[model samples]
Target: MVKVSIFGSTGTIGKNVAFTLAREDTVDEIVMVARPESLDKVKGETYDMYDALAARDIDCRLTPTCNFHDIEGSAIVLISAGIPREKGMKRLDLAVPNAKIVAYYSRQVAKYAPDAIILVATNPVDVMTTIALEASKFDKMKVFGVGNHLDSLRLKNYFSRHININSSEVHTRVVGEHGDHMVPLLSSTTIGGIPLKYFVEYVDLDITGLVERLKNAGNTIISKKGATEYGPAYAISNLISTIITDTHKVLTVSCYLDGEIENVEDVSLGVPAVISKRGLEMIVPIHMNDIEKRNFMKAAETVREATYEVKEHMNM
Candidate 1:
């Protein structure tokens, strides 16, 4: 039986992820952890989820706690505990405070769940992922951030809508930062196994507008709802399912690079990686246009600078 532990279970994303994972037959148990002050909120969520599970006839076990030690026996540790992005704030703005929180829990996870795969969902996720990897001292493959995976999904959704095709027929990805500087790999985008550019020749697609919308997608939702819940929650659960099912699918996620792609070293950026039961199997190098390559390099620098700031705070 596979058990997963979620930190910051009281948050919107955490709660939604808990519900989503609970419905998976492969997930036998879920441990939800929140700060001491929010323990009641997690307990309420657990009871609420139990009712929902009973209605569906699912047998997934649920445990709620304020204790970090209870995270033991977890196969996957999801860290979503941090101050969420505000209406007008950039993801990078939450770096230091969130990094401290992530670092504290990362150390505890290292101690309590040494062999678990760490999935980080904190804002400025690219930086926070690097922080988790460093603080936990976990293998790079065992620690990653759910970064461009959502952005890639957004891109896929856009292509599907514009081309009037099922979303599963579109294959595309957004790389680099999970924020403003993210690069849409149009060069590699495909629809029905054909290059997107080929379809562009026959379809009237506004490439510029689509990319702009993709970049602003998160803030657009946050400006109205104060937080993005379902989209990220589902996206995270999808990645976890891939790992738990041992599917060697290539997905874009923030992972540490040690001179892996284009000689880029010592930073975690969203790149295509093969995810399986062991976490990342390999980082797949995709073809990028000259302009896309430049934009990607810039995005790397953007994340690297923010990561440096948080590293200073942690004195790493």
Candidate 2:
């Protein structure tokens, strides 16, 4: 039985995660934590959410608290507490403020849930993951962001819809930051070991155009709904399941490069990794051609700049 704790469990992504995990048999406990200032509000909100879930017969031991000790001994710790990006606001625009928030909570997480796998869901996630990892001083493998998984899923969805095929049949990946600089590997995408091009001639598939769309998919959803929830919420829950089950699945996730890719190190960016309870057990760098390598490097540079910006913000 795995015990998980969500630091921002009253928000859209947080509530969805709480509700989803409440029904999972493997999840023995769920602790929904909020910032100290919003303790009462978050507790009330969690109670209401639990009531609603109970109405649907989704039962699990869900506890909401503002105490840091409640997060201790957690098998997984999810940091999703941050502001959403508004229209016209870039993901990098959120770097400074969200980094401070992530770093503060990361220290608390370090002190309490020292051994828990830290999963960051905050925006400009690559930057936030870097801040969290540095602040917590945890093993790099145990800290990651959920951005790449969602981005890759969006890429797979695009291919699935275009060819009228099940999404699971397509194997593709999106790397780098979770924003405009996201790199989609289209040149080598395959479906069940067959090249993607074999089926995409159905229409003049614009690879670059599709990548641009994949980069903006979150913004599009934010425009439609006040926030983008389902994809990210499901992405976090899926990762939790992956870690708890020790599936060691090779999924794209945002983590510090270390020697995973050329010219990108000490900065957090999305890359394919084998994930399990031991955290990112392996780096599965997707084979990138010359052009794809250039794109991925460009994306890595963008994240590197954001990390520098975060450092500047901290000094200020």
Candidate 3:
């Protein structure tokens, strides 16, 4: 049995994550925390979750609170508290405020649940993840952001649609910034263990437009819907379940690097990493072509700059 704590349980992603984890038999308890102002809403969401679980006859204990102390003994503390991006806003546009929010909660996590693995889902997640790592003073491996995992899922979907193949057979990755400069690792993508190039020689994959569409996918959803909910929810829950089960799945996520990849350090950028019960087990070194390398470095710089800006904004 595992106890998980969600810092922003009232938001769309948080709510979705709560419901998804509730269904997981490994997650025996969830502590849903909201700000004092949203205490009532969180309590209601908890009751609502209880009702849903009862309907399905799943016996997961759920608690809602505005108190940070209640998060004690949690094995996972997911931080999703931040301003949701507006239609026209870039993810970086949320850096300053979200950094502050993440920092505050990181400290609380450190105090109440220092052993917990921190999964940051706030907007501008890469930057917020770095802030969380610093503020919580946790080992870098224990703190990670959920962005590239979601991006990779989107990449897989796009590949499946264009190639008309089963999505399960399409293995692709998107690294670097989870934002505009994310690098779609076409160099490493495979379909049923076959290199993408073999198929590219025959099929018109429209690689250029594919990356553009992948980059804009999140914004496109945000433009149509108020905010993205289910995709991230499912992706994050999969990650959580993997951790609880010690599956050690290799997933692309934003994790800190210190010579794990060339020339990138002290920043959280999206890359493929092995996820285990201990949190980030290792950052897998995948091959990248010249163009993919250049774009990935650029994305690293973009997130690094934004991370610095957030630090300065928060006076950290």
Per-residue error for 287 in candidate 3, Å, reads: 1.0
Candidate 2: Cα lDDT at 102: 89
Candidates ranked, most accurate by TM-score first = 1, 3, 2
Q: Residue pairs in steric clash, candidate 2?
A: none
Per-residue alpha-carbon lDDT of candidate 2 for residues 1-74, written as tens digits (9 for 90 to 100): 57899987878888788777775656878999986777777778667767876776766678779899998889
User: In model 2, which range of ten residues has the least summed lDDT?
Assistant: 199-208
Model 2: lDDT equals: 0.84
Residue 27 error, candidate 2, Å: 1.1
List TM-scores for all candidates, in order: 0.98, 0.94, 0.97
Local distance difference test, each candidate: 0.93, 0.84, 0.91
Worst 10 residues of 3 by lDDT: 257-266
Poorest stretch of ten by lDDT in candidate 1:
258-267
Residue 18 displacement (Å), model 2: 1.4
By TM-score, the better pick of 1 and 3 is 1
Query: How far in Å is the alpha carbon of 109 misplaced in model 2?
Result: 0.8
- Candidate number with greatest TM-score: 1
Model 1 Cα lDDT, one tens digit per residue, 61-162? 989998878899889999999999988899999999999999999999999999999999998999999999999999999999998999999999999987
Quick one: best lDDT, which candidate? 1
